[model samples]
Target: MIYYLFQWLDDFGVPGARLMDYITFRSGCALVLSLFIAVIFGRKIIDRLQMMQVGEIIRDLGLEGQMKKTGTPTMGGVIIIIAILVPCLLVGNIGNVYMALMLIATLWLGVLGGLDDYIKVHRHDKDGLKGKFKIVGQIGLGLMVGLTMVFSPDIVMRENVEMRNVENSEVVIEYVQEDVKTPQTTIPFVKNNNFDYSWLTSWMGRGATAGGWILFVLVVIFVVTATSNGANLTDGLDGLATGTSAIIGTALAIMAYLGANIIYSSYLNIMYIPGSEELVVYMAAFIGALVGFLWYNAYPAQVFMGDTGSLTIGGIIAVFAILIRKELLLPILCAIFFVEDLSVIIQVAYFKITKKRYGEGRRVFKMTPLHHHFQKQGGIVTALIQKPMQAIPESKIVTRFWIVGIMLAVITFVTLKIR
Candidate 1:
């Protein structure tokens, strides 16, 4: 609302209002406003949650300092959600298609996650909302995002292609003159990094474009599901998900800025997405929200974000990447989340396989989710190199994981040129 008001004032010759015309300025305001909101208002929300008795139900997992977290306020994700939404509403271009998509995603997933957290706390269901319903919500958002990206006229991209300058006889990277809608994304370690989704359906000849879009929708669903689940699993430690998410959000903000700017896109030899600058504003809010939340979420935590924060942040990351055509790079940028996801799958699958073959279930990691494996004191009999035989302090584990997350973020950025 404030953005539109300022934008209109700029047309009326208002001096300071014109500053909103610059994305960088608006994004900075959004960051400061969101951080301020989360830090200042976050305590009140946590207090309200405590009054409501929305405390976490700690399951005794035998990890270091595990049970001590009981009775701490959960559902603190509401602070993050409010922080992001308020800043975006005030400082972002609400009419931009990219902005609209992000806001809808924030609300949609926020509600879904809020319900799950509500169930866990109020209803005393550790399982929370049913898995099927959660998946349905995620898939619905995926379909909505996929359809909007395909049909929205404002959502378009100019392809980067190499051209020879006739006068100089030199090859240079340049974007095509006109923007087009397509299921194309950036891939790493290739001479020309663009990979068109239609290639997956090239066998269909003239129908390839349509088929490719269908495939893209399915891919969106898969990415949303996997990323959300990964983040959910990674929420095991204090400040783990919050700090790591802030790091990834920072990297994403950079990408969104570069892709939306024609000059930067050309210089980087990457696709130019015309309307994606709004995503930078959104990501700034995301980072601010996380960092401020981390104030309470750090070790000896004052509050837990519960499912509400985990699922929403994960979905946001996935959608932001999709909008900027960087979904393929998620494996590298979001390696920590996915690794946590894989640890559980590996542990469960291996246990089942061993039980079937040898009449006794065996383990891979001492505990699932990978992070807990570090906090756990014992090693699985079948596991390899269990030298960290004693529990590592929770704070040390979180700090090290954050360092790894930073390394992944750097690698993700380098891919813009490494390709």
Candidate 2:
């Protein structure tokens, strides 16, 4: 709203109104405004949740201080959602396709997660929404994002072509004259970062392009579902998911800015995604919201994000990466979420196989969701790799995970130069 107002004022020759024309300026403003909203309004929301008895239902997991968090307010993700949406609406160019997609993703996941949390808290069903139902919701969101990308004419990219300056002995890259829609994405450690999904359907010949899009849509569905669930699972410890998401959001913001800029896209030899710079403003708000939420979400958490925040955060990251053609980098950039997700899968599969073979259930980790595994004391469960005899402090664990997340973000950015 403020953005449009500034635009109108700029038309009338207002001196400072033109500042909104710069992505950096608008993004900065969005960041500050989001932070202000989250911090200032967060306490009141938390108070309301407390008054309504919207506390978490904790099962005794036997980890240190586990029971202490039982009554902490849950579903505090509403604060984050409001903070993020308000700033974006005020400062973001909502007309941009990428911005519109991001806003859709936020609301879609927010509602889905809010429903899940509502069931768990209000209905007193610890299982919350049925697993199948959650999966269905995720699939529905994936389809929405995937189909939009396929059909939206505004979403297009220019392929960067490299040329040799024979006389000057320098290499130069140039963007094509026309923007083309393709299922190409950035892949790390390759001289040419472009990886076209069409390559998988080359046997189709004339129909290969269409087949590639179908495959791309499937990939989008899978990525969105997996990452969103990964985040939900990683929300085991205070600030673990929130801090890591903020880091990931920062990296995505940088990627969006560079991909949208013609000069940077050419220099980096990456796809030039026209009009993607608007995503920087959206992401700036995202980062601010998470950080502000962290004010209460950190150690000795005052409020829990529940599914409301985790699912939305993951969906945002996935969609943002897809928009900037950087989804291929998520495995590395989002390694923490992936590892947390994989730990649960491994533990479950190992337990099932062992039980079938030995007639008794065995385990891999003391608990699932890797973060909780570190918080468990050694020798308590039959598991592999239990060398850490003492449980690590929750605060320490979150900090270490955050450090790892930071390292991953840095490495992700370096890949642009390495390629």
Candidate 3:
């Protein structure tokens, strides 16, 4: 809204209105405005949730201070959704395909998460929407994003390189061609960062292009489902999901900037995605909304994000990575979420296997989700790799995880330069 107004004013020779032409400037303004909205409206939203009794249903897992969090307001992701949408609508280019996709992703997952949270709260079922239902919703979103990227003429990239005509010893840096379809993505620790999906389908010979798109869609579905589930698992502690997501958002913002800029794209030897610069504005709002929500979401929380916030955050992170052609980097950047998810899987599988073998159920961790494992009861517990048997404080655990998230963010960036 404000962006269009300023853009029109700039055409009319209005002084300083041209500042809107710069992505950095608009992104900065979006950051500030989103922060203002989150801080200003957050309290009121919390109050409204309380009035509606949209409280978290806690199960006693024997972790320290676990019961205290019961009834804390959940589904606070609405705050983040509003903050992001408002800023993007005001400052982002409404016509940009990337912006359109991001907005759809934010709202789509938000509604799914909101429905899950609603079921948990009103139906008094801790297991909100059925697992199959959640998976279906994630698959739906992934398909939408994949089809859009494939079919939308606006969503295209140009491969850039410094071409050398060896006969004359002349070199020129240029984009290969106009926007066209390809399954190219960035791979860390490689001289040529761009990796094409068609290479994986080389067996298809002349039909490799079709096979590559199929593989790409499958990859998108997996990423969206896995990341969203990982985030939901990481929401075990106060401020854990919100804080970690903010860090990831900041990293994605930098990636989007580099991927969208022709000069940087050429320098980095990556795909140049025209109009993707608009994503920087979206990411700026994401970071701001998470930080501002943290004002009340910090330790000794005033509200919880519930599935609404957690799923939405994960979806945004996943889609952002996909858009920037950095989906491969997610394993490193989102290691914490993966660890949390894996811990539960390992624990559950171990328990079931042991029970089948010994005719008695055995445990792997005192609790699952990895974080809660650190917040367990002190006792003899049969588990693998239980060196740190001593219980750790929740606040300390959250802080340490945050530090890890930061370290991962740094390494994620450094990997691009490392190769």
Candidate 4:
């Protein structure tokens, strides 16, 4: 909104209106505005939730201070959603295809998550939304995003092509003059690493392109579902999910900025995604929202984000990466969320197998979700690798995880050039 006004004024030779032409300026404004909104208005939202009796339901998991978090005002994710939306709408290129998809993804997942939070808090349903319904919603969003990438003429990329010097066998990278539409993504640690989903279906001959897109859509569905659930599982500790998401969002913002610039992208030997620069403005708001939400979400929390924030945050990260063709790099950038996810999977699978064979269920970690495992004292549950004799402090665990997240972000950037 404000962006267009300044853009129009610039065309009329208005002084200083051209500042909006710089993505950095707009992104900085968005960051400050979103932070102000979240910090200043977030308390009122928390108070309103308390007035509505939207308290969280905490189960006793036998960890330190487990019961103290009970009755914390839940559904505070509305604060984050609002903070992100307002700033992006005002400062971002509202007409850009990438920005449009980001806003859509934010609102779409926000609603889905809000409904689940409503069920859990208002209706007092421990189950919240059904698993099938949640998966369906994720699948619906994945299809929308994937199909848009296939059909939208504006969503195109100039892939970096590699040239090898015969004299010295040295490799040089160059960009194509024309943009191309394809389901190609970058793979780390490999030369000429543009991996295409269509290659898997190139055997289809006449229908190869269509088959490739279908495969990409399936990948989208899986990525959205897995990432969202990973976030949901990681939300157990105060500020864990929120802080980790901020780190990931910051890395993504840097990636979006570089990928959107032709010169920077060419120098880095990566894809040049025209118009993805708009995503930098959107991600600025995203990082701001998460950081602001952290103010109240830190240790000894005043509020909980519940399903609303976690699902929406995860969806935004997944869709943003997909839009910028960096979805393949999520394994490194989003390692924390996936690690938390894998902990639960390992615990459950091991317990079931042991119970069936030995007539007694065995444990892997003292509790599922890797963070909780660290916070728990070792127990005699026939578990494996319970070496932490004493429980660690919540705040320290969160800080250490954040440091790891930063290292992973650095690794994610390095992977582009390491290839």
Q: State which candidate, 1 or 4, has the greater TM-score.
A: 1
Report the number of clashing residue pairs per model: 0, 0, 0, 0
Model 1, span 78-131: residue lDDT tens: 999999999999989889999999999989999999999999999999999999
Q: Estimate each model's TM-score.
A: 0.98, 0.99, 0.96, 0.97
Which ranges of candidate 1 are over 4 A from the true structure?
166-169, 382-385
Expressed as tens digits, the lDDT of each residue in 270-388 for candidate 4 is 88899899999999999999999999999988999999999999999999999998889999999999999999999999999999999999998888899998999876558796868
lDDT of 2 by residue, 126-222 (tens): 9998888888988998888888988999999999888889999899998889989999999998897799999999999999989999999999999
Looking at model 1, residue 373 earns an lDDT score of 89
Candidate order, TM-score descending:
2, 1, 4, 3
Residue-pair clashes, model 2 = 0
**Model 3 per-residue lDDT tens digits across residues 1-419:** 99999989988899999999999999999999899999999999999999999999989877778899888999999999999999999999978989999999999999999999999999988899999999999999999998888888888899866688989988666897778789888888886677888899999999898888889888999999999999999998989999999999999999899989988877766779988999999999999999999999999999999899999999999998998889999999999999888888888888889999998777777778988878775574576556467888888988999999999999998888787
| Full-model lDDT for every candidate | 0.92, 0.92, 0.90, 0.92
Candidate 4 lands at a TM-score of: 0.97
